[model samples]
Target chain A: MATGEVKVLGSWSSPYVMRARIALHIKSVNYKFIEEKLSEGKSELLLKSNPVYKKIPVLIHGDKPVNESLIIIQYIDDTWPSAPSILPSDPYERAVARFWAAYLDEKWFPSVTSVGIADEEEAKKAGISQMEEGLALMEEAFGKCSKGKGFFGGDEIGFLDIAFGSFLGWLRVTEKINGIGLIDEAKTPALVSWAERFCSHAAVKDVMPDFDKLTEFGKMLFPKIRALAGTR
Target chain B: MATGEVKVLGSWSSPYVMRARIALHIKSVNYKFIEEKLSEGKSELLLKSNPVYKKIPVLIHGDKPVNESLIIIQYIDDTWPSAPSILPSDPYERAVARFWAAYLDEKWFPSVTSVGIADEEEAKKAGISQMEEGLALMEEAFGKCSKGKGFFGGDEIGFLDIAFGSFLGWLRVTEKINGIGLIDEAKTPALVSWAERFCSHAAVKDVMPDFDKLTEFGKMLFPKIRALAGTR
Candidate 1:
């Protein structure tokens, strides 16, 4: 079901780019992939396409360019109506899916990332607790969104799954490199299960970086984030 | 047309809540209003409705509840489909509107608000320049969204107008209190004109709090935000 011109400018380390990759893969859309050299600064294509942010995970559908991973995923869903629905067709359900996705970005994602790099012992503790709280909220959201189904959109993998799964690699890396147990089976059992299911999903398996490489990246990147974020 | 049941839990002075009000008013949907006083802590209804965030601007349609200002507005758009289109009907256009709305919330909104409350001259200067950059991005977005029309939704006031207009009162108050010129006539003619047109729109005009009262709120509230946000 190739509709011609679909291209994604992505950076391997960015979870956001991973998100766009998984979404496009799920829709079974054929497209081109352009690897961006992040250390060398934004590519000309990236600079021209997403001049505002000049950031990756810019999905180009034909002549138009859509930036932002979540928005791009939705664009893929809307454009490819015949493909499996990334979001539920019901308006209210769709809104619920969107709200949780935004919640993950706002409340959960940052907390998870912060725990991976927090310098001070006290701040790391605080970040852990904050992440726990974020997970609890996510647990509640999953109960509501899934309604006793396999995935957030019922029996199929959907938007929320993709959004949350984007972070699975990073989450594992955080646990490994930081020597912290983030997704404790005791506290966030549902989320832990969801993480296992999501990482092993068919479409997701291809794009996710190898665990060893990701862990190496995490070890290198996290201390830099800690240095930059500062204790003050 | 009257809905079976509708309710809004809001704060009198919250720009986010105001976004909900303007959206509801534009939809011409009949609904109940309940103002939550934050200083006194969360209302039982608010806590019950939105246990996760425990924030206001929760719109209840029948028994179902939707939280987050942007999400609520989109809910209003979807539920009250007969009313004026809150967003462009085209999928691509809708994605563009969503992207800019998120940009305003993420980039522009904070910069606009911070300038009003930044305690140090350096911080204030930084905020002012950051806001200038954000506004520049917005100016570009308006060019694409409006295409020489009155609002971001073309001839009529639409989603982006409501998104930006949510901050109109705060923008005016910031300009008046901070003594900083954000939207100069020569610099952002389109935004300046849009602000004027939005403030006067009938649905928006009725709900926007008085200038004097909002300015007073800014005076009392800003120092507190600076303290809570921390000087670091």
Candidate 2:
């Protein structure tokens, strides 16, 4: 019944927003993209769509606004079942897929982002350590999901891949801005290789933001975030 | 293929653990229960099963363990599809259910717990205000989901009910212990009535912990949690 057409309320730099785009691409969902100046304040449309959080990456399907990236991605998958299924068809496998996505959202992403906003050396160090722990867990998770396959989610790109893969560029750029050498091949070979595979994928390559452009954006914003987070 | 057994690694007094129990009961899935002394640092079985987070309410099915309560409930629905579905068959409705569950996890649950953990009166007040905000949203969400029906899920208890309903007792006990009134009829009539309906249901009643014992547990744990959270 999507008479009004599909639209995504998002900004370029957010990994969460990237998820909505990635799912759309994989599902071949043609959605109108609306950018929001996230730092200034949420737009009226964004607020109206997602009044609870007032955050970006709201997927407007016809008149209904679906907030939260994971939920939105699943919505995309559910809405368009014929398109390359993001999650596995098997029940247990689907649960495994969801579990990792939640882990990435709760652990991997936040810890990595913490490195940028935390002003103090100790806090940044803690964040780095936490990120390393999360990465280690993801490395293990990838092994289980792949089990001698190309992607973390078997041969083709799947939900977990989209979940973590969407953030590789932003995570890398943020790490450089924070002046940390996390996610290097030497330290985390498995994850680094996984990132490479992810970037090479047409689904990711077509949609991901340019690294240099993202880095430039990070330079402007990371400092402000650091200030807001306050020095220890 | 569940030759081993269905088991829940959990302890009473946890809304998360309650969710697993409630979901199992609602689905009428017969499962063994393993009581974990979470405060004493997770047991080896619990650790091995759920290494990433190592938290409780892990639903073990035939040796495969599903962590995270929401994921577990969905897993139950998926594994036992013959039973009542926790989520709707319709993709859009399913997405809506997930959105609200995420909202409860991210907004409602945390803000309510914030009241317990926060030390200062100002912080607690802020937590209450946020919880109020979350409840108001849930009120609107219920209206949308119900559409002149009984449950937020309409006609039957479903995912959102399990998500928030599982915590009603814990929330009420915590509120009493903290000496703050949150879910009063005047403030959150819709939610209040929903709780009454949820508790009265055979599926929820059969599995939920005894109220008097749970209240005693909350009284003891609240102060300890407050101290750990660094409050007076």
Top of the candidates by TM-score: 2
lDDT of 2 by residue, A157-187 (tens): 8998999898788778867776777777777
Per-residue lDDT, model 2, residue A105, is 84
* Candidate 1 clashing pairs, residues 3+ apart or interchain: none
lDDT of each: 0.84, 0.83
**Residue pairs of candidate 2 with colliding backbone atoms:** none
Model 2: per-residue Cα lDDT over B99-143, one tens digit each: 888878876888877877677889888988888787787887888
Candidate 1 lDDT by residue in tens digits, A1-232: 2245899999888889988988888888888999998678788899998877888889887778889999988888887777578988777888888888898888888887877787778877887788778778778778888888878877788998898888888888877876878787887777887777787888888888888999998888888877876755
Q: Which parts of model 1 have CA positions greater than 4 angstroms off?
A: A1-4, A230-232, B1-4, B227-232
Each prediction's TM-score versus the true structure: 0.93, 0.93
Give candidate 2's root-mean-square deviation (CA, Å): 2.3
**What lDDT is reached at residue A127 by model 1?**
77
The candidate maximizing lDDT is 1
Write the residue-wise lDDT of candidate 1 on B107-225 in tens digits. Answer: 88888777877778898788889878888887888998898898999988888888888887888888888777788788898899888889899888978899999999889998888
> Measured against the native two-chain assembly using Cα atoms, what DockQ does each of the candidate structures obtain, in the order listed?
0.50, 0.66
